[model samples]
Target: MVWAGMCAAIDHLRTHKNGKLIIFEKGGGFGGTWRDNVFPGCCCDVYSNLYSFSFEQNPDWTHIYPNQEELLAYLTAVAQKYDLYKYVRFNTAVDEARWNENKKQWDVTVVVNGGKDSEYGSGYTVTSDFLISCVGQLNIPKYPHIAGSDSFEGKIMHSARWDWSYPLDGKNIAVVGTGATAAQIVPEVAKVADHLTVLQRAPAWVIPRHDSIISEWRKSLLRHVQPARQWFRAESMKARESFHEAVTQAESAKAKQMREITLAHMHKQLPDRPDLWKIFTPSYSPGCKRSVLSDDYYPTFLRDNVTLETRTISRITKKGILFQGQESETEFDLIVLATGFETFDYMHPLKVFGRNGRSLTEIWHGLPRAYKGVTIEDVPNFGMLFGPNTNLTHNSLILVIEAQSRYINALVDAVLDVKAHGKHLSLIPKLEVIESYNLDLQKTLKKTSFADPNCNSWWKNSEGIITNNWSGTAVDYQNLVSDVIWEDYEIEETDGSETFVLRRKASTHIGRVNEETHLSTSTLRSAFVKCRSFLNWFCYSWNSQVDTQYEQVLKLSSDSEYNKPSRRLET
Candidate 1:
């Protein structure tokens, strides 16, 4: 859906004006995550309004939680609506993007149809001013490392790579990991499978989805009187935003209430087994992990045909799975792994070389850092939509993506301005700025639900640092990206100069002068002299970068313009 919207925007820029856009997809089609995950009972966890692009709202959503197929259809419809098909080149994967400092363009190398050995054959290179990576987090499917995984006689598959050709009717199925995919799959397969075993590491906190079909009249009302639908969406979004604040804020009443509600739901569902409840209930607080919504997931577990196993698996033998304590091994006709994807790797199979021949991997070796989670230093004319620390466990990710799109567009505008003026410019955030931002982010992350040691989730890396998730509310992020701070970056202009010289004023404060007069160099010296008598000598270093003219302006003014503080800035 995101790629389709991006293409649509490009198309709008094209025929309506003289714009160029080329979309490359590794797969045969352009649905992104929707095209990849074809597992049974796969549906969106977020509400239809929040999940969809704000620019394109589907009032005609068949179910409250639209299935993958319906979502893919919506994307297709969106593509057709904006005539974006012409811009898309399917069956092409990006191999590398090298930044050309001289030309100020990205030299992109793409492997076409898996190279010469495959159908399309050979590789090609394309250069463009701007490069946008729309490949999302959930595109790749993860398979668990198990003994005899390859040696299994029966069919084995990841939930994302479901084989429709092999039927599941009356088969003895063993599903590993009861995450979102397993939650949906269990209900669907329970009806058909003779016996199903669910291997769960830890039970998820499930909320009621309350999914239902939209009536024709409701659709009509939504189509004509769209404000009504908009109002509903607004209210829903407001509630979600409030929830985000409640979760982030320490020991809030709203957070307590949300926790109580989740606990109540869990108790209501599993009244019989306290042991199961103890295992299922999270040690950490709610909202730490991605909150799952499903009415059928708990009820599916109650089915007589299905059995839930919390036992730790020793290994996967050729016949079946072996539990740590169990004497007997559980055999299965088929096995499905619902392990999620490696979301940390933003653009897999795509090698990016920035200025000074630095790979993105080398830059972000330990921790993923980006300026405002969108733009990275040294990677000229490249912006990521839904980049590092932008993924939200609460609320909508689409909101973040939209904000990123706006930032990218603004960046493009900045680049165009440079081009039109015939000025050689490079926009890269300062190293100090990015480092400070990351430090602040780490401070806030330490206090969040994700930092809870009791819980182990995919949101954190091996070091238990959350590389995903925004530290604050969506509104905060919106305000941060709404306007670009030119001072935060260095904009260099090169007119065949022997060496590039930065033309921005240094950010240092000199000594203050009197309230009435501007600060002259003599006055600054006198102020520093006075300060040295009382305070430490190192205080003078703080004002070293302030030029005489700017210092004079600061001295003349009441310092109100510079220090009219509002809220403290978050990292």
Candidate 2:
């Protein structure tokens, strides 16, 4: 599912130019995550107002946090408004995108017509001069490697691929993982299921979210009073701005205060279950992992049928999961794996080949970095929307995506300008610029508590290097790329001629003629009179009013004395 970021980029490019945009939607249609993730109680972690594109806001959002179906419908509406469906080739999955340096275009390999009618037919190649990859970071699911996990005969489901046909009522269900996905699923399932066992690996820094229904009157005010929406969005953005510091401050006063608040919340929810409250206290600092937001997740442990298990798994059988130290093995009718997506894995499942056939993924080696999180110096004419170092803790993804889109649009125009001037352009960012930028980024992050040695989170790679999040705020990114640093780029002329020509020799117009030599005296006046009458008649007809100007011209033209030019319109 392609989200608003890619949609806005395509719309901008298409509106500015008349070129056809061929969207390779791997899924059946648009909606990206909203269409694919339909688990019970699925809702956006981000507020609904800021989640949408800036240009196309959905005032009719049902709640502060919209559910999956509402967000999906909003995406579908944006697609229809821009007539984006005509350009989309649905059910076409891209295998590899190769940059053709010789042809100066991208050669894409895709599997088209994968629905029932065509039966997932053969592969074909399509090419484009420029490529924008919006294949987002959160699609692939990660399964746990428990011994005999697959040997179970009962129904198994991933959170991303929920099995809706299986009912939870009167069923003993086992839920795996306690990240963001499991937090939402546990509360909803415990309310209906006969019994629920939540298997958790580590505790998350869970916080309370003030998410409530956006009343009809408020939605009405926001719809009609446009500033109300803008004001609300501004307030929401300002509220989240300081959270990044709170999470990154380690055991500092701010971090300690946040930890205290969270502990208090947990205690309030689990007043009788001090053991459950202790289970939630994390060994690492806050913001080590992306924090979860929900009101009912902690209170779920109070339910009589809910069980929170934090033991290490020994193995799995058809009956259920076996604990490491305990001999009693639990059995369940169904198992739901809320194992999260590969968030740190950028552009997974799609291999990209850039300049000289070098694999872009091979260069990163599971740790991706880019200049401004969009441009890789080695890769020319290729860009990404939500690339590495772009995930946010205290800002909107849509805001960052728009900033990247606007900046990348400038790069796209720069490439087009080079071609329009009869030159082949090859842009490779200078090596020092990228090095200096990343160095400063790492330096900034190291001082934060998130960079503490004890903190092990998805924000970092296997080598203990922070790879997923931005070192600064989203506003900092917006200010950094507000203008394209053309000087930092190595723009070479591929034809071996020269760099861009700045100044040319002076020149002047040579062809000239006197108006009197080519035209007669009566001819000019007669033409002016005829033009005046025609314009007058046209203006009146266009305004849906009648005029006698053309009739007067006809009467004057027929007169014997009217062969001479009329003097009235001479000026």
Candidate 2's residue-wise lDDT over 1-571, tens digit each? 2773455456555646665568888888888888899999999888788788877788788877788999889888988888777777778878899988887778999876555724656778888766787888788887877898887877888999998988999999999988888999999999999999999888888876656665665566568757546645654554455455567667655566668767877888779877777788888878787778878999898889999888888988888878999787788889899987786767777888988898887767666888888888677777787887777875578877777777776666666767778776666667688788888888888777657666566677777788777877666666666667666776666676544533211211211111111233244334434654543343333222112211211221232121234311111
Write the residue-wise lDDT of candidate 1 on 301-363 in tens digits. 778899988888888777888889978778888998888887778777689888888999898
Residue pairs in collision within model 2: 1-32, 248-449
In angstroms, what RMSD does candidate 1 have relative to the true structure?
A: 16.0
Instruction: Give lDDT for model 2.
Output: 0.72
TM-score of each: 0.83, 0.84
RMSD of each: 16.0, 18.8
Q: Which candidate number maximizes lDDT?
A: 2
Which sections of candidate 1 miss by over 4 Å? 1-16, 114-121, 421-424, 494-571
